[model samples]
Target: MPKSRSRHGAKPEVSPGRATLAAACASLVGIGLARFAYAPLLPAIIGAHWFAPSAAAYLGAANLVGYLAGALLTRPMASRLPAPALLRGFMLLASIAFFACSVPVSLVWFFVWRLLSGIAGGGLMVLAAPTVLPWIPQSRRGVASGVIFAGIGIGIAASGTIVPLLLQQNLALAWDGLGLLALVLTAVAWRGWPARSAPAPTLAARAKIPAHSPLPTTRLRALYVQYALNAAGLVPHMLFLVDYVARGLGQGLDSGAQYWVLFGLGAIIGPVLTGHLADRTGFGPALRLAFFIQAGAVILPALGTGTAGLILSSLVMGAFTPGIVPLVLGRVHELLAHHPSAQKQAWSTATTAFALLQAGGAYGLTYLLTATGGDYRLLFVIGACAFALGLGIDLVVGVSLSRRRFA
Candidate 1:
């Protein structure tokens, strides 16, 4: 989706701050509340006997499947429709999905609602940042982007605190509370969407080969695989963290929720801290180091689920969950330096790849969980190995580049 502009190609008069706020709210509702909130609630749904554990895990995967579909479809649909309108519709759709999920008439019914929420989330993810970033001054875009994505953290933190409290009463009430929160966020963002401006570039136009650009095809291929592996590596934590805490380690729901809260706290600062690190160390170094650190963090739980270990694991992994985004984007910018068009195109492809692998990984892990009878440790070990593999790719690519430069 293209940035929202006005007639005559003038920048939209919307306040950059307010527009940023709106986009943030969209992300919070679309991704934060709609997607991540389900993680904390998953154990509750299973505990309440609403669904078998394996069945509920599959339901969680359904949202990811829908997210992949939505990501693939959003740009094409945007071609025929106003992006702002579509964003608003998606926000509303997500809120409605929350309410629909509260009913839980059957497994299929709950799956469809979760899928709809995921679709809404994917639309918001694709459309929200692009729609508002143009309004931000170039010098301040970094801070603005961080603020917008922080909505995901805020939502995560909010769910950690709020869902547990709501679940105290009943599962239905918990879903209703989330729906109400989403509606409030939607209403706050209702007016800040930029009006449609210039027509979006055609797919073919965006995809046209840059005949003589300084593109690093070999390194880019490595980056794409690394990104996919990173997505897969995160599946265990995203879907099972709370459940592992509450059920796997035999901690109660309240204790598990506390760990999630720590995760949220880490998420809230992850982007800002990681972005600052990237600025200081350069994207390549920072990204490669991140892979190594994340591998260790992901594997911590499998090694020992003690209080200290879980805390460290939750905080570090939480930080990297959303934190990896800026690092990847910065790397893309570095690779495609002075090529704005290619940067955008490459980033779009990267996002699609991440979504595709994220969905696939979710289902893969879900099946593994069923096969192992929900062996949380095995999942964490597998996730850590993925990060290790990504790190290995980066190292190999770096060595190749060094050899070619000396030759």
Candidate 2:
């Protein structure tokens, strides 16, 4: 970390915990509220006659498209503007988007706002942790990151628990309530961003840094594919799990939201648990295990939507949803442990791949749902198959690498 000082040339004290909390708030708005909230809200939108079921589903996909655009553009945008300013701006944008959604103006209007929120979320997701982690000590960074990322799960849990109560009044009130919650979070995080500029490095200090090594291109490419596949596998649950439970099972909105609540709870603990497992077993084994477990969870709904089955599926899938992020990143760092630059580049590539497939899968599944008259089971089955393929890639890579090591 670079030395930071005030304008008077005196060292400024920085609190890593406060900074991490601020970043977590940003993520809560970006992904937790912006993206995950839409799933539970989907059924309600359809029920209120705001849009046809198909249009509402497409609206959900619009956020994914914007996320891709935002993620791709954030690095370049940061080069021109300060990260703190950008983070603040994105949070504000997301809050505004939520307020704008309160009125169902038209499909195009709703889509544009949803897309903007997605952009805000994507930018925040990319920038938040990177901004805060540099200030944290190496030993505490893992726990700090888990707390920051847990904001997503927190948001999910909040929406599930809060949206229903808000909807008791009207759909507009529900939207307004969400916007107010986001605005409050944005206010809390307003001053949390650390100072951007660090003191310049001396020439001698710069010379001590080693050159980046060549990347493990083959393994990286495989990782990217598996990461992309994982996104495809997650789309069904992320977009339709609430709807599947509420309408598909004829259980009503309240019951479906209950399941989402469970998913959120799983998400809350997933990162901490998965990170611990990786520490003991290594990132490779942890990731392989994640794929296998997520595959079973995704496929469970297809085999049977019994109450116990749905409950188990929801918890497991929810846990793995955000839980898989750390595992993939740990794998990336492990693969490029010697090359910090390459690690950043590879992680960016993996994120892009995930976003691309996420958007594509959302649209494809929406179409499939329409064609099959809303066959929720088929979507779950397809999602499971995607995870299965990702598992296969990992197995193949593991075997091939083992052979190379032995040879």
Among the numbered candidates, top TM-score falls to: 2
Clash count, one per candidate: 0, 0
Per-residue lDDT of candidate 1, residues 310-357 (tens digit): 999889888888788778877886787545556656766776788899
Candidate RMSDs in Å, in order, are 4.3, 3.4
Model 2: clashing residue pairs?
none
Put down candidate 2 lDDT per residue, 214-273, tens digits, no spaces. 667888899999999999999988999999989998999999999999999988888767
Give candidate 1's whole-model lDDT: 0.84
Model 1 TM-score is: 0.91
> How far is 78's C-alpha from truth in model 1 (Å)?
1.8
